[model samples]
Target: MTTLYLLGSAAPPVLDIASVIERAQARGYDVCLGLTPSAARWLEPGAAGLERLTGHPVRSGYKAPGARDVWPPADVVLFAPATFNSVNSWALGLTSSFVVGFAAEAIGKGIPLVAMPCVNSAYARHRAFGRSVAELREMGVTVLYGPGGFEPNLPGERRPGGFPWELALDAVDALAP
Candidate 1:
């Protein structure tokens, strides 16, 4: 089975990540879960359950230097509900967080990558957001954004449509060699 690193940032969608993991598994992926620090904290209480669900420990911070990697090498990475901060940090090559760091390095390692942002419109309007999206696309990451992908909602308003995990998974499946 293909090993998929399903990474998440701090977003409302992260709350439903268990379902996403199940969906990915249903699609025949060996799912490994990674989360940004804040997201990890938010989901701390359920961490063990999530680990059980994925059959891998949930990783938020980097492992000790020179230590073996706990998870298998990712055949592909699906970073969903990437926040504005995560997107910008990743584009700029900031590896302060494990999830973003893995994604940034995945580009040069030639791993297939897919990303879908879950920003509010107000945040998306920032100049950096567009640049970050373009940068990731330029690096050959399949970014699901705009009409056919995720459309940002207005600030403080709930998006009636939930995060588009299916669309992201489709993009991941379609990733080119």
Candidate 2:
């Protein structure tokens, strides 16, 4: 089975990651979850559940410098609900968090990466956000945004009914070489 690293930031839908894993499995991918530090804190109570669901530990921090990587090599990556801070940090090579480090390395490794940001329009206006998105796209990461992809919600507006995980998955398939 193909291995997909589903890296999530602390966006709203990180709480529903179980569904994302189920969706990935249904599509025949072996799922592994990697969460940013804040995201891990938000999911602390459910760590065991996540481990059971993926049959692999949810990586939130780097292991000891020489520790073995337990998860399978990633065939592709899905960065769903990628957040403003994480995207910017990732573009800047700030890998203090596991998810950012994984994303940065994956890009360099030529692993197909697909991201869906859950930013409101107000935050999307930040200059750094645009630069980061452009940088990620330039690096060959398939960012599902703009026309025909994920749209930013307006500030104070409830998020759309469903986050677009399918788009991320399809982008991964399309980008796989």
Please name the candidate that would achieve the greatest TM-score relative to the true structure. Answer: 1
Worst 10 residues of 1 by lDDT: 168-177
lDDT of 2 by residue, 1-177 (tens): 999999999988789999889988988889999999889999999999999999999998888988899998999999987999998998899998888999999988988899888788999999999999999999988888887777888876876576777777778777654
Question: In candidate 1, which residue ranges exceed 4 Å CA deviation?
Answer: none
User: What TM-score would you give candidate 1 relative to the actual structure?
Assistant: 0.97
lDDT, each prediction: 0.93, 0.88
Q: List clashing residue pairs in candidate 2.
A: none
Give the alpha carbon lDDT tens digit for every residue of 1-177 in model 1.
999999999999999999999998998899999999999999999999999999999999999999999999899999997999999999999999999999999999999999999999999999999999999999988889899999998898887877888899888878733
Question: Candidate 2, which segments miss by more than 4 Å at Cα?
Answer: none
Native-to-model Cα distance after best TM-score fit, residue 23 in candidate 2, in Å = 0.5
| Clash count per candidate | 0, 0
TM-score of each: 0.97, 0.95
Instruction: Judge candidate 2 at residue 57 and give its lDDT.
Output: 92
Q: Which candidate should be chosen as best, given lDDT against the real structure?
A: 1
